[model samples]
Target chain A: MKDWRYWLAEQRGTLLAFGIFIVMFVIYTSNHPAGFTANVVQTAANKGVLLAFVAMAQTLVVITAGIDLSVGMIFLLTNCLASWLVVGTPMQTTLGVIAVLAVGLLCGAINGAIVIYGRLQPIVATIATGAVYYGIGLLLRPFPGGSVNEDLADAMTGRVFDVVPASLVVLLAIVLVIWVPFSRSVLGRAAYAAGSSETAAYMSGVPIRRGKFAAYTLAGLLAAIGGLFLTFFTYTGDAAYASGNAYTLFSIAAVVLGGVSLFGGKGSAIGAIFGALAFRTIGDLLFVFDFDPLWQPLFQGVILLVAVSLGAFALFRVRNRLEWFL
Target chain B: MSETTPMVGKSNGGIAGRMPKFIRRADPAVLTAFACIVLLLFLGSLYSRSFLSPEYLLQQLKVASFLGVIATGMMLVVLLGQIDLSVPWSVAAGAMMACAAAAYGPAGVVLAIPFGIFCGVLIGIVNGIGVAYLRIPSMIITLATNAVAQGLMVVYTGGFSPQDSATGAMRYLATGFAIPGVPNAVIIWALIGAAMVFVLTRTGFGRTVYGIGNRERAAYLSGIDTRRVVMIAFAVSGGLSAFGGVLLAGYASKAAQSMGDAYLLPSIAAVVLGGTSILGGRGSYLGTVAGVILITLLQSILSVMQMPEAGRQIIYGVVIVAMLLLYGRAPASR
Candidate 1:
């Protein structure tokens, strides 16, 4: 294949997700009562960024061919922790932010240790850790009331210079500061190699364990960022079990919709961002159409089903039955 | 190539052949689970005098019966080296649909039980098609179906709480005893357990499921309809999960939103606890029964001790991880 063709193939998933997001946003804005005002866009951006952050976290672990079921719980845990700590004086809030992030990193590291060293399957191992994380979150916030630093929360969640959503700007900064460098690093390549074919990667002398550990640890950090954003938006912490589970499930859906292979070894966090944005738009679309709010869940489910089925078309091209296993 | 062949053969014989027949034949995981069950029961007896009473034991078994039904489906899917994350909603869909059916007059009342199970089977078929024909991962597809199921239920109930009650027959099947002293739920679980054992041991379909799990390529090459087996396993799993939901609703005499939520992880945990490889292919029905009982007792003991929800969750997670570390490890390979 030509160089440009190869590049296009590599970026196809991201492009498709971007296209989907753009289309959905356009449709949503055109039908809205407010007609795509700055305030309307700001509200939508704020809602979308939460899932976008969680989906990005999911993308990292998924690139290593491992699933992290605990991202949502970590998001909840850090949000609860932040609601308590990210308050008081400016100095105290800064220290609290660092602590929350550190705890998130610790949670991710523990998951990595169990999966890599303890040799447990990723799915089952993460499920166990997820429960523990949620328990801690529940312990921290038995009820839904805690305060955050109001000034910091407002600046983080409000529009930047009355034009762009501040949350979107932070999300972009994170992608640049974390994702770009990580993807270009040696560990990222090793993680990808392992996901594609572990035995081959090992034979080729890949640092599979360290690479995966980095992916998982970074995933925790990203989820913590999401949790911090949640605290900013809500200004209180609630250890709601249903919502935690919903976020976990929705992140997976977002990742897949972004064209990241659940089987692993492909796709980008950028794509996942768009996927998350598009998914959030589903709820908005229903509102614009004046449908009952009850239609939101079904519509989201149908959209996910269709997006996922689109990926399955490749199966038809396989001539040999054995290739299906591969 | 010739020298390597003998080396491989010698290594296998030197290690495996030396083990005693009894040790080689038995499943250590299942035995360990049973031992834990005994330990839990003994621990519980210390909390209250009635803990060891026949009445208490039977009550625990009755509670376990709900999980037992769900785990049976989970095991079947696991045996195919696939998972069905849609169980929670499949269960809810079944219960809600059955209860809804009952509200449609006398004819609907008679069909409620079958109708509930059939809703689950339909969900399974959808899952099977995705995993089998479309080649979507079972994890993702099932997750989607679960969302879809949840959405459908929400729309059906109009986001308000469901008002349908379990039918008279449904209630009887769950709580009433056909045989004296034995609860009807336990008897139903026993029948399902017996059928599962027979199906897994004596049937060609069972062999095919194991074959697909071990190596789908080999199974396909051997002319087995691997896709069909996979589809059937999912369908069966869906049906069983729904049945569990139905029984749960019957026990309570009414259906509730998200009623099946409590069963999903416990069912998966129970199957795993019973020595069923989460990777699929090797397990026994008896182990599942033991796992179900053990989990029920453990929960009872924790509640009796008045542990907080947070503590209970932490312990539940820790126990699963500890047990997994015990015998669920995959054999080392290059």
Candidate 2:
């Protein structure tokens, strides 16, 4: 139980992020007299499904002290692959879906292979692969012209029931799937241990290489999920359109904002999701204000910086604040 | 390093005296970079006989020179353990400012290079302060600066490109071809590259920059003023990027607001391709020269091949991923 104290102390970023999210939700809900309708909640929840998934993938790799610069590129490739596969192909719909996921998984595996066997750094390797993958997608579809199956997109995007949005349901399902491995599994703890101290983690018998591989592999899978969402959301595959690489930095920011340390160790998947929601909520509200999109990048960068600064300040709780002066 | 290293090791044989060239093994990355360049060139040659012509090669050299000059500055910053993403816009800002200063005529022509360099240095200081003092990651801070700089360009140029026509030595810097067959821009880039190699290897500041990159805290603890070194590295980067802009203006016979656009990736690519560790601390300037040629060659090849723009970007990106993965993954910790 005493071990938990170190955790609570480390989680200031998570608390702050959640606090901000709740505040935004309250502000939006309170401003409208009717307040917090299913549609509004569904919209946020729907956005959350993909953002959180992508955020989780990025968070996992980042927590292992690596960055996947290629996640967006992978998403674009996967989305385009999925779109390309859907038209007049003899494969079953299930097989087609698998093929799309395979596109992402294959790319991720390539990333993993290079990162693991080739001894590449995550940032450099991913950036390079992303370019390649992006090129492949461009080759596949020089222009943005492809369609997702209407029925599948509709089903995937539709609300699960009257009370719960389908996207939220999917998100929860993903969370449930990850929770077991994340919390109870041996590999999971090793992931944290490896991130915390590679030498020590190795000395302590954590399979450092294997754990890192798993983390990246999982990140690849999760990025594919983001691609899957794009299939539903946009209802088309556009190679030229991007997952927006800024989101790569933003996801990192969200994780950092959620109080996940960039240097690895001490972070939570749930925290990342909340952080993403908090980030998106800010964007949503900003959109409501009708500010130009150009300002959004600058604004988001500022917010991310502030959030990190506050997190840094709170991490030391005045001790480092004094250290800054010293 | 290759010159001094083995001889130094022979004289001092004790444990502490044993030399460790940061490059411990025969690197596959250098080979990969070479292959990429060759492949691009081969494709270009296949695409058109003119691709191998001196006129075309010289033009390619001119392009390489501009980015190569900027890449040298970028490589230094990378050596210092940071990146300067604002170099793209900083180059643009330099061109625009130098073009604006052209109203001063012949004197302005000579002075434009320094003036552009000054804008870069000022921006570098701001970037340095953001990273070294305020401690924002160079990526985010420079991204903001990039946006701001570009936006400023939009406002200053009023969507029209800035034009400069320099008829004196300034034009000669970029336009005047050298002895035999070289374009002036190529000659200038080669001169700068050579000078940088000398500076990086011979100077105290250069050693300190590499030292600071290896471990900032350790350098500080060892009584090195890390902040000052970082500031200086960025200032140099700014100056070089500006110099590239100046030469670009001269070579083009006019300055455009977005002349620096193609430079961003290729500059970083050259640094990475050249075998400099993007993560800082373990690299060389000579590698940058190699990288510059490699990227320029590849770009020329692609352009000559006449592939679609998106395909070209993809090819470049994939090449980057390959290089990144094959070599130069930053280590897991500081």
Candidate 3:
């Protein structure tokens, strides 16, 4: 295959996921009572960004061929922390924001430390850490009532000049600032190499450990960003267990939908962002179509199953049965 | 070729020779779990005198039975190097369906157990087909299945609490003591555990599961029906999860939404804590039993201390990590 052809093949999953999201969004907007108006767009953006940020976080760890089950917990933990800290005057709020982000970084670091240095599997390590983060979150906001800096929350969650959603802009900015640089850097390539084949990466002298550690830490930061946005949106800190778990599950779905291979070493954060948007749209689509609200989980599951199954088409082409295990 | 063969044999012998005799004789995980249980018991005694009482300890045993049943199935899947994240809802579905069935009449009540188990079997088949045939990752497929089951149950209950109560038989099975002071739930768990131990140890099916987990291709090359094994493991996992749910419903007297949600992590934790390889193959039910007991006792103690749910979760996560660090660091023995 030509270079471009290989590139296209490489990006097929992301593109397909993107296509699915666009189609779903279009259908959703068209069927909505208000059509594609700013209000509708803003609401969708606000909801989608939260998942998109978290999905981006997931994409990082996933690209290293490891999963972080605690991303949702980190999101919850940060939101809980933000509720208490991001409430005072401007300087205090700034410090609070930094502290929350630092806490997220620390959470990610712990996960990375356990998985890498401790040589524990990513799944188990994250599950444990996720529990700890969630426990801390629960402790922080046991009653689910805390204030945020209202002015800051409203401005960030609100529209930018009454047109484009500010949250969307922030999401875009985050992509440019964090994801773009990381994806282009040496460490990012190392992460991809590690995900693709850790032994090969190590043999090639890739900084696999650092790359993976960076991926995990960045994942924490992204999840914290999501948490901040969540606090902004809800205007309070609630350590709802179900919601945390849902976000974790949904982020995985979005990652898969965005064409980021759960197997790792493939896919992009951008694709995952679209995947998150598309997943959010699926729920909204049901709402717009006047389906019973109770049917939402089933429909979402079905859609996710179908969407993920699309990625499985490649498996059928495998000539060796052994490849199936991989 | 002869020289290389001898060298390989010598190297293998040398490596084995370097290890202590006892290390080679026993699985370390079983011992660790045993120690942890003893330590937890000691800690519980330290915390409160009542905790060490037979009544309280038996209560913990009964609670462990619920997780034990689920972990038994989960161990099978984990042994195969796959997972069934659908457990949470499989459990809920089982409980809900069984309860709903019992509301019909005597025949419904009689069939309730089977009916609930069958619901789990159905979900298991779906999970199996997805993992074995469709070639999707079990983690993803089961997660999806869990959501689907949750959705179906929610719609079935019309978004309200389930109206059906546990059958008389179920309540008895969950809460009643059969041998005077022994909870029927514990007996049920023991029976299932025995069956599992037999299946995992005595049968060709057990050999195949270990073979597949160790290396599927090698197992398949050896003419073992790998896909069938995978399917069976998942089916068993689903069925077991549902069974656990049924017992839970009986214990609680009614099925509630998301009742199974709490079990997913703990089940996985128990399996791993028992010293089972999360990647698959090479584990024992005895180890898992110890793990279940330890976790149950820990939970009871924590609850007794009035630690909030969050604190308990933190400790739970910490304990899993600690166990993993202790056992999971070693490379898998092929």
Docking class of 2: acceptable
Please give the range of 10 consecutive residues that has the lowest summed lDDT in model 2 chain A: A317-326
Better of 1 and 2 by TM-score: 1
lDDT by candidate, in order shown: 0.88, 0.73, 0.88
Clashing pairs in 3: none
On the 0 to 100 scale, the lDDT of residue B165 in model 3 is 87
Error of 1 at A178 (Å): 0.8
Order of the predicted models by TM-score, top scorer first: 1, 3, 2
User: What DockQ, on C-alphas, does every prediction get?
Assistant: 0.62, 0.24, 0.58
TM-score of chain A of each: 0.97, 0.88, 0.96
> Of all true interface contacts, what fraction is found in model 1?
0.57
By lDDT: ranked, best first? 3, 1, 2
In candidate 1, which residue pairs clash?
A: none
Name the runs in model 3 displaced over 4 angstroms: A1-10, A312-314, B1-24, B159-162, B330-334
For candidate 3, write residues A167-262 as lDDT tens digits: 999999999999999999999999999999998899889999999999999999999999999999998999998788889888988998898877
**Tens-digit lDDT track of model 1 for A191-289:** 888788888899989999899999999999999999999999999999988788888888988898898887778999999999999989976788989
* Interface RMSD of structure candidate 2 (Å): 5.1
